[model samples]
Target: MTTHDLPRLRPEVVLGPALRTGPKTVHHIKDESTGCFYRVGPREHFIMGLMDGRHTLQDIGVQYRETYDRTLGPDSWQQMFTLLGRYQLLDGHADAGVLDRFRQAQQDKQAARQGWLRRRWVLLQPDRLCATLAARLGFAFRTGFVVPALALIALLQTIVWTHTTVLAHDASHQRSWAVAVPLLLVLGWLITMLHELAHGVTCRHFGGSVTEIGLSWRFPLLTPYCRTDDIVLFHRRRARVGTAFAGVFVGLLSLAPVTLWWWLTRDGGPGHRIAAALLLFGSAGSLMSLLPFLRSDGYVMLTHALGLVDLRRESYRFWRLRLRRRDPAARDTLRAYPSGDVRAYTLYGIATLAVAVPAYCALMWVWFARLRHWTGPGWAVVVLAAETLVVAGLLLGAARGRRADRQAADA
Candidate 1:
């Protein structure tokens, strides 16, 4: 069976009694004598090994052999126990009886999902899976799809990645990808350079300097950014809306080349098709850049258009407040609030839900159904349902949150 087939160990119960925590719940654990709390995952296991403080380095080695059936080689059990003791979960040669009950609880819990975790852990490395797929599919055949599909994928990836990085992040900060104008210009294509430029132009039209633009790493990724942090200090609605929509405007501008080419070569061959495909790719990518859930240009526009800095945060708070039987009005207003511009946010959510759910489902269905062959109506019903559910869910959730906020304020 695939590693994904393995049962998942409940994260809440992974530590058990030695956990100093409870089942199906997250709780704090501390050693009464040492006064050290084990807050993280592996540290808990390491701490448990040191409960029997009398176990010598050699004794612990022997215990590992007896229990886990292993020799204490490099990075041995003695070392682990010693490390645990140092972390203050154990006192050297201190009382051991207190831990006996905790130890038994841990051992019982360990047996609950041992094999499942091991298998699932093996499956979690996506790079390895991609490597395997590459080996099986062969790099040459994969490239065959590139002629028509790669451009679209590139557009989508670039759009989403750029939006998440540039317009949504860097532009908000009033920065650019780099100091050099040429590098800045190149970055505009890939890093929301044009998007930010559109913002700068709009701002200049309203009398403002195009500040700095540069690059930064946002952990697990690198991106070009345009800093417009200054304008927000002014609190100008027109500027906010313009800056928020700059990237989208740029994306729209990009459509011109493709649209022109497609129109000019409506009766042409591979060249026309390639141009059309590139257009579709860029268009799709630009649209993805506007997805609100992921903090893209669309998200930025929604935030500014709605005059809310933390709309997602508000949505999450509203959701939580619902569970707690509390009002969400104060929470919604805690961030910036739009004055009767709710439609922008509503449409943004609707558009995203409409596109993302169907696209995601369709992709999944296609992936599964295409395991044996290339073409047919595959897993269509699932795709349609997924799409409808996503759209409905977003619409309902947004409406509910707004209603809750209004009710809370009224009360």
Candidate 2:
């Protein structure tokens, strides 16, 4: 706090190359030691820049007053230094225990996960060697690659859809669930990896580095996802949107080979059966992601499009506000956003949940009935009831998991 006390920024802390988003010029603060990235606006960047060995804290405050015509408060100074120190962005001298607190926070996070979710196992990263492989594959994001891909997908889908029949049937048509189940599971796992890869590669193509490639649990369901927090630094909406739904696009593209092979082989053959199972599961899962009510790719895309991060929560509050006759106690958070966003949230929020639930239940029922090869109407009804209960249980598990996560954080 003394005028003579000159604090130095850590040599390893690197400011970004100055990205422009909207009206502000911001930089991504990257700590080379921790591999941590944090976003800061121009003013915050100025504060950090002034942390050179020459300028003391008092001098930095004077500089801030000169620049903004107002004295910088102690709270601002505390927050900035606390963050910088927590991330180890400052040199030898900072609040002595901030780094310790940061380490404790990380340890607490690790301790919070109880039984089945203690750790995530990362499967593979093809680009670990030759890191520039993704950069070279940037052409894949362009129309030249996409248009041909789309054409091929259409051709393969057409093959699966129409004019196909069983020709030379195998004698071993006794439904091999034992072999098929394991094989299908492995195939699905790889497909999930492919989905995450699509996101990572798309992000790299759009000039963001892939931080981690791994598998993580989505509530009770184990799903694969990639971390590209660098997307926050990506100023363009197109880049962010492309990164968001890249998995969904890859899911769609994968159908080409599965559908084509299914058509080429005999209907009763193992290849046909495996392909059918994958197609069913992949299609259903991707469709589920498209439900805007749920937190999936489609919802992410919609949220980014609407330019509202809290669309679902705010929209619910808006509706609640209306239902209670504009009660002052209820938060009308959506009112601050643009009129377009308000309307979009209002329509998408309620309508998506209302329609998607039954629609999902119907899809599941049909899928189960098809798998069982149920012939009678009574069997179909039973399948519907079973599928509905399964969906409900999964939903309840997700809700409980979310609550647990929040409680852990609070604790």
Candidate 3:
């Protein structure tokens, strides 16, 4: 179509919330028909926002010039149209070639689900349940209630911290490992379920959808997961951030009563011991979920707050290119992104490595210490060496996978 032609977005395509990072504002657009999401900058968002079957490309170009003091040439118009058509975001019927490519992509995705590690079992569809819960308990999401709840959680955590030594002693002194171990496992699993449910319910409370509740196994652990994919479509940053923080908030809040029980009861009593164990383990787990290095609640919250998409991947790519600064192509690619984004990527990459490297080292040290205590120093060293080799191999494999992904994207 020419600049004189009107362009319209498909009815099924939904625009997401505005995410402001420094001087840049990014917007997410989702195609409900294909369940695909795309991130666009302010200029693109402005153009797309006016695509209501009434705005001609020429009209949009004039407005864009007035707004941004920039002109869109024929090449830019062509590129925009190509992007819209490729994503099936246009209102009219797509070309046969585009339809064929889309179908092939879908088929490829379906055909690639052959690995056990990538398999997931959907336990139930929780959309209706989450909707009902959200409707009934919507008041809990209000600022009036949330603020007080957060304050109380902070107070409880402070108390737990103050009495940490006593709680640890009480929990450790419990002689029934067999019983306590199983109870702790069950309690931890239950807490995780509530954590995932909190995300689903809060998403629904904020005009999002929770479609699937499922189980996925990740090597040593099997965990419950809830799909709140619709959070990406929220129009408010507060709603998106709140949804990300909901699980961590609920997980910690759920431990309040147990914390109180541990505090109030006789120190060595069964109730006090059980409460101490649950409070200590549950609180540790909840807090750990806030470590930004992991793809956990904190990472999601940080990304939403910063209004950045694929922060980890982008940050890694930025650092990789940065280390190859002598390469003209790498330097040019780095210069292509906004200065704000480049600064963000640099800061995030540095911070991630700063925190993650030490954390990994500490974890390895702890593992070796525990093994030494159990199997003597020589065996501990042997086992640690073997584990180190395994981890190195895994890291290499991941690097190769990323290289393949980059090549595929480039292709």
Candidate 4:
């Protein structure tokens, strides 16, 4: 194409807000057609931003020169065009190479589908539902409602904390432990569904799409999830943060009625025992979601606030490189990132390891203790062996994921 020919980006392509990592500002470009996300630096973003079919290459070059006091040569222009074309980001037909790569990606995705043990069941497309809910429930996002709700939750939590001993006594004396436990589990699951919906509704309220609301099962764990990835495209950081916090907020809020019930019927009864147990379990779960070490609401909020993509992966990679100080190939890995990012990665890696190691150890100890009591010593040993195999499988999976991430970054 000639310099005067206009280049246009695909209409469905979405450009995310500028996210700063270290000294560089990066922008995310999502190709809705392919469901692929690409990150570009400020210069590429500037060039792509003008690809509206109205600005010719000459016009873009002129603007670029004016802004940065630099001119792009013919080769530079060709390279930029090639990169865009390879990703099929430009409007119109893609070349054979791009089509082949796209086909291969599709095949890879098919091959990588989860097995029966760890599966995802997409219940429904929740975009329309979320939009409707957001409209009707818009007032809930207002400060007038939020402030009082938070205060109520705080007060209820304080009451629960103060009456912990009495609640425990009631729970122990109750005759319906077996029935109440199962009922509490069911109630918790229902609240979890609402929690996912809350995330979708909040994203919709902030003008973001909630494409999927589904259940994901990874063996022993099955939970409802809402795909709020479109929140990244939002210009307002608070909107992104709010979307992340929505699930946890709804989870904690669900305890309000149960807390009230427990307070009113402090008399040692089955109903009161159930209510007390629900309060304790629900509160613990909600608070656990606020720990940044896990891929939970707190982690999501941290990433959004810091504008760092894949913080956990990056931190892990940083530590891996740091530990291999004698390896020449690994030495350059840390140098690629800016000093600020390197420091961030180092600190996060250390903090996560410090917390996660002790926490996991304690969890395993408790697991073994429980298993020993429930089963025999021999059966507990067998169960521990099975658990070890599961952990090994998880580590292998993580390794594969890291390799894939590195390949993507290189590309």
Best by lDDT: 4
**How do the residues 1-411 of candidate 3 rate in per-residue lDDT, one tens digit apiece?**
642387888887888867654334678787665555577887888889888888887889999999999998999988888878668788774565765676577547544552443346788788899899999998898889999999999998897788899889888977688888888888878888889999999999987778678886543356677888888788778888899899989999999878867767864656677788898888888888887765678888888777766678778777878899999998887777788788888888889889979987898899988999899989998998898898777666656665775566435
Candidate 1 lDDT score at position 325: 48
Candidate 4 Cα lDDT to native? 0.80
lDDT comparing candidate 3 with the true structure: 0.79
Please write out the lDDT profile of model 1 over residues 237-328, one tens digit for every residue.
Answer: 65666666665655656555555654566555333444444454456666666667655666666665555544554555433443554446
Ranking by TM-score: 4, 3, 2, 1
TM-score list, all predictions = 0.36, 0.64, 0.83, 0.84
Name the runs in model 1 displaced over 4 angstroms. Answer: 1-192, 203-225, 267-271, 326-363, 370-411
What lDDT is reached at residue 322 by model 4? 82
> What lDDT would each prediction earn against the true structure?
0.46, 0.67, 0.79, 0.80
For model 1, give the 10-residue run with minimal summed lDDT: 16-25
- Which is the better candidate, 1 or 4, if ranked by lDDT? 4
Top candidate (TM-score): 4
- TM-score winner between 1 and 2, please give it: 2
The better-scoring model by TM-score among 1 and 3 is: 3
Distance from true location, Cα of 283 in model 4, Å: 0.9
lDDT per residue, candidate 2, 1-411, as tens digits? Answer: 542278778876666535432223457776544455566787888888888889988889999989988787879888887766556777875443765565566546645654453345566554452246576776877899988987876665455444333211221232687887888889887787778888888777766667567666754566566776666555577777788888877877887787777666754555777777676667667767766754677777776665554456556656666577565544343344456755775687679678977887678766776766655766766767786788688767755775687566445
Flag regions of model 4 displaced more than 4 Å: 1-4, 20-25, 92-111, 172-175, 268-270, 326-336, 367-390, 405-411
Which residue pairs of candidate 4 clash? none
